[model samples]
Target: MTDKQTSPAVSVTLESGPAGTGSIDDFELFYARRALDRFRARLGRQGLLDLLAADIEEGNAFLRECARTSDGEFNAGTTVLQARGMTSAEFLAWMDAAFAGEDERPLLAAHPEHYAMGTDHIGARVVENIGPHVCSFYMGGWGTAAMAWAEDADELLPESEYPRKMSSNLFLEDGTVVGRALIQFGDTAEGFTANLTVYFPTSCPKGVLDHHLRHYAVEFRNWIVAAAEARA
Candidate 1:
């Protein structure tokens, strides 16, 4: 994760227009480097969200919301009982689902809400940890969920199982949302690509997320390409 400047040999063929004539090899080199650089670069100190709830239920609810908004990973089975830790990407997917109101009913079923039913199926819905850091979050509840997507339609959820949120709401506060961008180069995919989609809402004006996402996108793309070549 060194920030050494890249050599001049690495460059993006910007002139190669819509008609397309840039060397794919060079593009791959550029993409990989830029991805690594942005990854190591320091994150801004604003626009972040963190939470801590005083009430256990609310705190647990908030945790649920966090899981809903986070990414998780799975073992090669369609069940949480057999699966393992969460990944950054998986946490993101879970967050999107929570935001979409996919699992509110079951998530809200914490104790006081339902006691007999609670102890019956508690061991399953849990997330080990999402990020590299350990203390970013703590567990709340447990259950098994099967993740399905239209994009990776072919690759079914690991053993058809996805981990469930363990807790609900906690105390939430402002914290920066940090992520990286990397465009992998393949023969068919020549132009730049963004893996994460910054969504916009009906209440706000259009393109707010787009502006931010694109800004990071370009920086990440260039950084990935640059960093990959430097490592070589």
Candidate 2:
């Protein structure tokens, strides 16, 4: 892995938006997006979609088995992000809009080359570039009361309800199941809290896992702020 310290920082100036003047956060996101755009250009749209489809098929089976057996070889970890002045209901509604493609700009603003296809149900695909990794996966989400993954969006609880959770099996291009992520949301006294639990194989390096924790912090913080701004 290349040392992040060795990478040159690129500064950016935003002429207009919720982010009035650019900050270090904006600069980092800008650099990451530029890198991801270069990557996408190399692969082309069709080529990337093809790879995502194959990975979905293979990764789903691997994730299902891991979930069933409580596999010991996988290490599970959680990272939580909290925001003030936003209710969980409001956040869920925003998520619904994002997943349905009704308004995905906030989501797109959260990360580099983030693409979500299909509704927030079984078989929905999400492709994201985090640092040097291009993660592709099929997603499923459910309410806390639900026992299993919903087959379609119709089976899910209304976005305004409680205990909403989304999950996916992360995969590499070759269909290797690198990890799984479960994102759960809850209402707090002041606002909302999102808990992201990830499972990675024991063989995965600590540095890699730590990097993901940092990645989640950056992207989710941006996403929450963007969503709030949109609502405002």
Candidate 3:
């Protein structure tokens, strides 16, 4: 007779942002922390989904890597990006286009046709200039469309998990070097949830990430303000 084994539940916690005091530095810190946590949560949730959807061979690997710590917990990091002016639909649409468009071919080293189009890991790209720190387009994920952790529509998932949508990646320059961004939509005061995760390579300075995040917040404000101006 075979003994039945049950896996432990996954626990997820999002870290808090900076304290909200009426100061410029405090405000900036608060948003930065917000972006980080939101992004992290979205990423973790997606990972959980992937783990649940893995094949036997792959599932075992994920279980080993995603094992609960001795503290009976799993720690996941996330971030947020706040862009005004655009509706959630508009923003999401823009993301889809930017990711699969021809602009990404140079960095990705292959056209959109190179992959089995419409999959999650296809020719995704991110192109934006938040502020003084301009981020070039970069390849997000490249390969099959099927997510390692996706389940059929009828499959049940844990209440703590959320289905996530991925965004294209951002590059530092026109080179093949890689950078990434992931997003999860949620309820927010600014029209839509802009849960975002932006990552840079280890070769880059940590300070660069801080600067880019700040600039990115400003960039979002600028984009919406500009859109409003265009309409006016």
Backbone collisions counted per model:
67, 0, 13
Better of 1 and 2 by lDDT: 2
Q: 2 or 3, which is superior by lDDT?
A: 2
Which digits, one per residue and each the tens of the lDDT, describe model 2 over residues 23-56?
6686787788777766766776556667676554
Candidate 2 stretches with Cα past 4 Å from truth are: 6-72, 102-105, 113-122, 141-164, 167-178
TM-score to true structure, per model = 0.23, 0.59, 0.37
lDDT of each: 0.28, 0.61, 0.40
Residue runs of model 1 more than 4 Å from their true location after superposition: 1-196
Q: lDDT (0-100) at residue 3 of candidate 3? A: 26
Model 1 global lDDT (CA atoms, 0 to 1): 0.28
Query: lDDT ranking from best to worst?
Result: 2, 3, 1
